[model samples]
Target chain A: MPGALHRVLFVDLARHRSWVEDRADLYSESLGGAGVAIELLREHCPERCDPLAPENPIVLAVGPLTSLYPLASKTVAMFKSPLTGNLGESHCGGRSAMALRLAGYGAMVIMDRSPTPVYLSVDAGGVRFRDARTLWGMSSSLTAGRVMLEREGGAGHRTVLRIGPAGENLVTYAGVTVETYRHFGRLGMGAVMGSKHLKGIVIAGNGDLPVADRGAYQRTYRDLYTRAVRSPAMRKYYELGTPENLGPLSAMGALPVRNLQATGYGTEPPLEGEALAREHLGRRLACSHCPTACIHLAALREPHPEAPYFYKTTFVSYDYEPLYALGTMLGVEQPEDALRLLDVVEHLGLDAMSAGVALAWATEAFERGLLDEKALGGLRPAWGDARVYATMLECIARRAGPLYTLLGEGVDAAAAEYGGDSYALAFGGLEMPGYHTGPGAHLTHLTGARHSHLDSAGYAFDQEDMKAGQSRSPKELARALLTEEARRQVLSSLVVCFFARGLYDADTCVACLSAVEKERNWDDLMALGEDILRRKHAFKAREGFEFDALRIPARTLEVPTPLGGLSENTLREAISEVERLLASGERFSHG
Target chain B: MGKRLRVVDVERCVDCLLCAFACARRFGGGGLAKSAIAVRSVGGMERGFVVVVCRACEDPPCLAVCPVGAIRKVEVGVRVDADRCIGCSMCVEACAIGAVQWDAVERKPVICVHCGLCAQYCPHSVLAHEEV
Candidate 1:
């Protein structure tokens, strides 16, 4: 921790001044990423600060393992969510972490608000606040990023983070786009950036970093690279990417179709992974240090309507989540329709999961006669109609009318305002991710931090139980889920991509950390992980989060899961057990 | 036979920068500042990447342009001598493909010696050390 990993950069946007501080002690204890970010969030953010207010600080942190190890590619972003209004934490895997680390800093904190639109230009010359007035109000995040990329002038070793019109319009579920296709895609981090009158952040640097043992570092790096390329654990992602889940999940009767109305596709699901790969998969991409290259892009070729013999080609990024949210969840029958809708959301800078669930609610509400053409701005809400959904996304991003504005607040707020709570499909104020596995998946969403399915991966656990033909008590299930979640804290704190969790096991994690820093061992790393989780919960509790007050939507209980009909009482009991376990963990007090 | 670094497939490059990392590690450190190899996207990575490195030109413009005659042609590529170099950066401008990457900290041009250390770590086989 002698070099960039020991320092923290702080930028006060309101004051238009910045400074760097050596926080070696903090980095030594927290080990960076979510661990360091949570401590910084507590120190900089006030207890009752409005999530969208200028006083709410944004913390971007990278871990010690980043840039030195393979698949240690994620940067942890901590902010008070404009969507959830609690702990807003999202991890992005792109050039974000690599660029920040190469720029010679372990972490960066953006505080206060700028009076006018601006972007922070970080380079070897250090931090400079650049005027972004002309770049503001761009049609898409890609355009804004391009404008900044040309002006800033760091082509190969740089990362440009920008938001599109949805974020500029203050859509509560908007996300920040990184590179062009990857994103810090959940929990309204983009809206928080918009509230500060910030348009983008440009990072560029190429400084050398120190290691505890150079020989050991090289050995560990080579071992990791070999495993990443040769391991069977990564073969699935290497072959078809995460979209490989589509076939298996659909076959298991766990894929949620048309807003959880049905678990299976019935006769013929129009959009299967194999078919998409055969017909449309144009390219494969990866994060900075990852070799798996799981990110897939679809090539959509269409003829120009106005002219003959003219064709237009568009590349759209696709993943299991977007395919589940925009494709199956919206009752989209054509793969082309799903890709078109995905392109619209990417252009508008909206979180596809939230946008899809909100649209699904609106479609159901329209069918119930609750939403009329006047409310919809003359557009009709119908399933499998890609054109109508595309227009609706534009309207929501622009906040075209009162009804559209409500939809911008996410499905939870929209449902509360328009009276559709029973089937709104949001857990703990955040839109649900794509999963209909069993009670474990549902319980994970309700109890996990950030309301993310990856927080615990209970769906995987549910499948294991079914395979074994064994049923565990609710307490047993809760313990198993929480234990795995607690262990994941170690991985995320190391800032490694969760996709490589199978490769970066506990022994490997300890070896990697020890290779970078001599002070940290296995016990110290485990203690740091547990402490980070506890501190996150403490931040939530201070922000007025109530564990017992969460409500399970009636549709969640109504749907027959793969394990059969799940009663409400079982989910409630699981939640109670999670609460008990969280309360019993060692307490944390701010220094 | 001597080793020569080769970009076997530009399409196979995922822009992971693992090869660049391996190049930097040759200096007994970590970072992109000292690496002699660089990978860049063609506008967008959707098309592919262009791996820029010293391809060992037979004529060698870098050797012709060096004022102090610090740069010399090697078996597979060019090598820069820090003692005789003036840090004028003429060699950087002379190279057509911008393969003569500079070491920003030392203000000297970093020409690859064709060590093939980078090719050893390239997981995708995008880079290889083949016999000339």
Candidate 2:
């Protein structure tokens, strides 16, 4: 193994001291990325710790194939979630993984809290705590990024992970904007950073990496790069990006529209990805080491309100999740209106999925007379009210008022406090991602350790079942999802984007591992992945997560999916099956 | 005639860093340590990127300013003789375009050899190699 991959960096914000530790065992046995990051989190995090407290550590990790292979671009960030109050794990692309890996550490653990606003400047030398008082409280995170681009060196080679005023206000779903387009967007890592008074973190390096076998490394890189660029699987991503799914999912009656009041747009939706691309696409970008540039930035041109002739163009990044949450889910039909709401959320650096779902609930509550206009802070929650949504989203992001503060805690918290618990869309404190496919989506949301769709991708499983024209039994479905989740841990541990799951199978991963570290087989990875997932579940269990006590939102059962109405009893059976499968897992040992 | 690598389409570059990685691979390893090419965003990514490498100047400033006479003009660009180099970095200072990449570990300037490996792996046809 490369000597550098064995190194871990630890920083205490309170003392403002930074140091590196050589733990060869951590990397050699567990491998890199989440494999080592989860172990570090277990050691650093205290039991029954406050999610916002200094006891909760933020562990950012990169894998062995990070710089050596294409599409190995993600950095896994694990912490105690301010939203879920359980295992908080988010993966970010952009230059983050490459920056941290090249900065000469496989993993970084940030602890303690700063008394004043500050940002960590990390390079090959060490970490520097710079005062960010001037940059703090900026409404737009993009403005802060621009200031950072000028003030700091390592342009192109460095990543600036920063939060906006929403984070400063401690919005529970606030996300850390990575560079300009990507994000650690789920489970509120930004809020955790906010609680610690950390404004931003910049990682940059111009360091060398040692490859165990140069010839094998070159061969593997060539094969992977060719496959990534040449394959049809990735073409969909680079061509039109993820918004490509908006039209299909909507047509298939899987898309959630108007707070799940209806599925599908019923007609050719105006906010379809192809239409958005043709009308608003400004640029396409790639994460470091990724050939497919899937990050699509839309050019939203708007004239200044007072000066009609003058215009200011903004570039907003859009995806399928945001389109569902902020667009169709709110009955937002106009492409520009959807883009505007998306821009507002992006500027605030809040998780769009959570914000959109929270807004949907608020609108429903208002419709049901559960929330009056006074409780809504004199703002009305109406469907497709983009102007109103723009203000409301801002309110939620900054926690501007009492109502907004409740909304910022996520829909579950708001519903628990207010009288709208029945329709609130959150499964386990964390608001659901944009999928309303069937029982599968809800099952994953309820049982997945992070309470996130990416945790198990049950939406895809629903689609596959739809294609086959048959649905599996509850026990069969649970076993399949658990197996997939464990297998995905392997890819996640390598820290690659899940989009590349087709490429990095067990054999291929083992082959890649041989070029950097010692030879390890597929069984070793399977065992390691299972062990890591069990540990995450163990953490969540310790943190008061009860699978049986999972809430089944009334809206989930009321809405008829493409797969027909999901049986509540079947959903419960699936949950029990997951518990059973988890118990029958083998343990991994450190060699 | 000399073969040299050049930017074909600046707008087409996706900022993947494959060209830079391929350049570093010529050094027989991974990472961007000894890469001669640099691709950086012009302000922000929305504005596109600027690719910097040896422009193969006829009367190279890097060759002219070398205090130890370690740099000499080759067919197109100049070559640095590491044995004679004193690690003064005068050549690096003299290159106005910042094409002379300094290696901190070796205390030497890493100049592009015009190997065309960067062009072959560009994925998008943002780079090109041609006889000039």
Model 2 earns a TM-score of 0.97
Cα lDDT listed for each candidate: 0.86, 0.87
Q: Which ten residues in a row have the lowest lDDT in candidate 2 chain A?
A: A582-591
Query: Whole-model lDDT for model 2 versus the true structure?
Result: 0.87
Off by over 4 Å in 2: A1-3, A154-156, A586-591
Model 1: DockQ against the native? Answer: 0.78
* Runs off by more than 4 Å, candidate 1: A1-3, A266-268, A586-591
Provide i-RMS per model in Å.
Answer: 1.1, 1.0
- Residues A1-591, candidate 2, lDDT per residue (tens digit)? 332887899999999999999888888777878888888998999987999998899999998888878899999999999898889999999999988888888899999999898999988787999898998899898888778757777533798899998888889899999989899999899899999899999888777788888888888888888888898989889899999988888888878888888888755875888888888998888998888999999999999999869999888898989988999889998989999998988899899999999999999999999889998889998999999999998888778778899999999889987878878989888887878787788888988878889888898899888989999899878877777787778888877799998888777898888986778888878888888888898888888888888888888888888888988899999999888777766332212
Candidate 1 lDDT by residue in tens digits, B23-48:
99897768777888998889876778
TM-score of model 1 vs. true structure: 0.97
Kindly report the docking quality category of candidate 2: medium
Candidate 2 lDDT at B84 equals 96
